[model samples]
Target: MNLPKRNSEDGRYYLMTPDAREKLQPLFDRCIRDAIDGKITRPDSLYPPVVVSSEGAPFGVHYLAMDWAEAQRAETFNVEQAVAFSENLRRLSRWGEIDHYLLGVLERELQKKYFVVTGREDDHRWNREYSLKPGIRAEDVPEPLLRFACYVAVSYKVYGLDFQYLDTNYLLGLVEKVRPNMVKKLKENGTGRLPLNLQKRKKEHFTASANDAFAVIRISAKDCTEECYSEVLNYLCELLSQEDFPRSYAVEFKGPEKKYLSITGLPKKGINQLCACAVQYPSLQSLLERYARLAMRQYERYTNLDDEQCALPGSFAVFALGMLGQPWRQLVWDYLGLCDDEHSRLQEKFLREYVKQFGFTADTVPIFVRGVLSMQSMKYSKDYAAWMANAESLGALLDAKARLSEIVPSGFSSDDDDEDDEPTDETEAGPEEVLQYAWETVCYVIWGKASAKRGLKVVETAPEELKERYRQIFE
Candidate 1:
């Protein structure tokens, strides 16, 4: 049928050609007869009728003609017009079955408008209420809804109202129709096959046996005195023998005897920079620093001795077995070896301290306890020796200051605000300046060394009694 060309200029009306009108006549007649027979009804019967543009609108033949003309001239048929038509048909006794015929017509019209049909008429009602944006195409329906449709099709062997005509090809056809477009979109967005490598790595890292030892050694001039290398070797041996550590990993003393003990298994990869030890530890940088210092001191001390006596290697492996499968609570309990009563007390004390420090209540105490245990594990690892040293220095400095405050009595001074006040000048300092000050202060107290002598004048002024007390504590 030759349909009238849409008017490009105004975009409102399209004249119905003779051929197109003839083609549409049968559908229109069927709808009209159905309406007159009370086979159709308005979906929303409570809504008020729309006001006619012209005065004294007629019913029956005249009304139908007016509506036909309006539909032809208008950009689209509005909700009010659709509802009025349905209601008029119902009143005329055109519809036989309210649920079957009326709902079927609505569904047909929605499909023609390119809506992906949902299994729910309730959803349709909600969409109308919310005035949801029209879907431009079938796939514009949400992914969850599409998946739900697929699931229903698979489980019930049904396709919409044609549920009785079960066919395997119907479900296969749906999948075939949607798959290509979905895959194309995924590829275009660079998401297809994106996570494969990450997933594989995680699987391998979690499943592999722990035969490799990850070691961090520190060397310094001070550690070389009094057979310090022998002592370090002894410590390494003890660490390897611990029941919790991987039995397959071993460390050798190699001192004077040039002998080595064989562990049950060893990883194919040798000790190298690229080898990733699966063990999680805190303050790795500090640990490495301490190892380097100790190593250097050993080298300096045993310079006169044979190479075998001075060179000491240590390693410890972490096992992957049950690592991922174990609950965090069980892991903590096993690691700490806490007795039943001690565990309860630990949980209570941890909860109280955590709430006070972090200012949040938790639903479970286990999560906070796990976090504390994790932190402790990291701190005690060989990797965190440097961090421990620095932390120790800071702790000592604070302790000294606290002792000084305790020993010295406050003098009767005019500056009452001094008791609680901070140095106001620091507020003006940039982040870099603040960071530099912190770093220097930490180094000075911990390592008894400072990179720069500058900024010492910024120290807060105290009363003569306080100053004397601080000096006495240091001395």
Candidate 2:
């Protein structure tokens, strides 16, 4: 945490009815339209919410992270708009006259790619010399952040109430507009990565882009006063910081003055008695994870969790509005009560829903099964193997799949078919052969079709062999 509050690493938000959204949309549009119509649009257009706050709500209710006005302006920003904004700032700064180098620096700053540097683990994000409230253990937030974050946030509470927020959604539209150009420049810049220099006091393994930007500003704006160049650089740094993309954003709830949700800590998972702030709010925290995970998979090149753990996180990325999280997954969180070991209970509630939502696809079912097994449970792990060993028909019989009936000698049914209570032998294959082929097809997909085909003949005939072999995948 810097001495003067830096806006980028910190964030803000609002929660209002659909009605409030309508009022805010037009005011934002009004600002842009006015700008195009020759009135200057400043970043502070939405400042002092009374100027632009939605009617019938608390004044100054607008989320203040990027400032509501800045956020609104970004929505319709084009690459051309980004250029104009930079040029406009330059003209106002009189920087070209002061230093031609700064003209280039300012231009280059516009085209920047930022990365997050999550420092130490085990630091509390928020505490009042706060003892760890008994909850699930989580990665720690840095102590400096916890103590200093109040100056960072809290005062801007919408209606004096803390509003939940998104990580990148609060991002400036201008940043998104310049993204393509930023990538090109990043390549031209040839690795912004510097050799490891240990930051001693903070214990942070890495430094933020804000720090990097300030250094550049000091050198580039040597002619300007400390106040002038520093202020400009700080503002620019805040914008660049927004581009940083939070490493691991989370949600925390505590009813207090600066103590409840430790605004000071790194915005990772929940800390202290929060029970690992990651899971409590499915709608919110998971969305942040999905966003961060997506950034890693598509934009960045680092990862903390293993490939197997990436199952859920990797599902949907690079899909804008059209993407959705796996609904069955959200259900799994709800089903996990105090402990995670209730595999049978969860399978009934969780996996059963999955089968319903997704009919037996050879690949997804196997992959999904593995993701479920990733849940940390000795019982789930041990019991899953035993369950599969005893299971007949790859557990298809346990699904919403058509049931076996004496009336229809064709014992199997399309699990995909909802209306058909029992399967008819539509294809030439017999019921036993159909189930066998289904199981084999599933096995083939998991081990990859190119391999694992040779064992099919022996396994198909021997139930015990098939069960043990299937159980091995879990092991």
TM-score for candidate 1, residues paired by index: 0.16
lDDT of 2 by residue, 1-475 (tens): 1111111211111223365555455444443333333243221111122112222112122232123224422124243343333222222221122222322222222212121213354642221122222341222322222211121121111101123112111121222232434323332331233222210111112122212211121111212233322332233223224443221121122211121222222223112212122223344444433443333211111122222222121121111111123543433332221111111112223343344344444322443433233233212222232233334435542331222121111212223232334433232355665454444333433334322545454345447746554444322
Error of 2 at 321 (Å): 27
Give a tens-digit lDDT track for model 1, residues 96-180. 2122332333233322233444445665332322112364434543343233223323222211223322322332233334444
Worst 10 contiguous positions by lDDT, candidate 2? 151-160
Off by over 4 Å in 1: 1-113, 116-120, 123-190, 193-196, 202-204, 207-351, 354-475
Stretches of model 2 off by over 4 angstroms after superposition = 1-273, 276-330, 333-386, 391-451, 454-461, 464-475
lDDT of all predictions, in order shown? Answer: 0.28, 0.27
TM-score of each: 0.16, 0.22
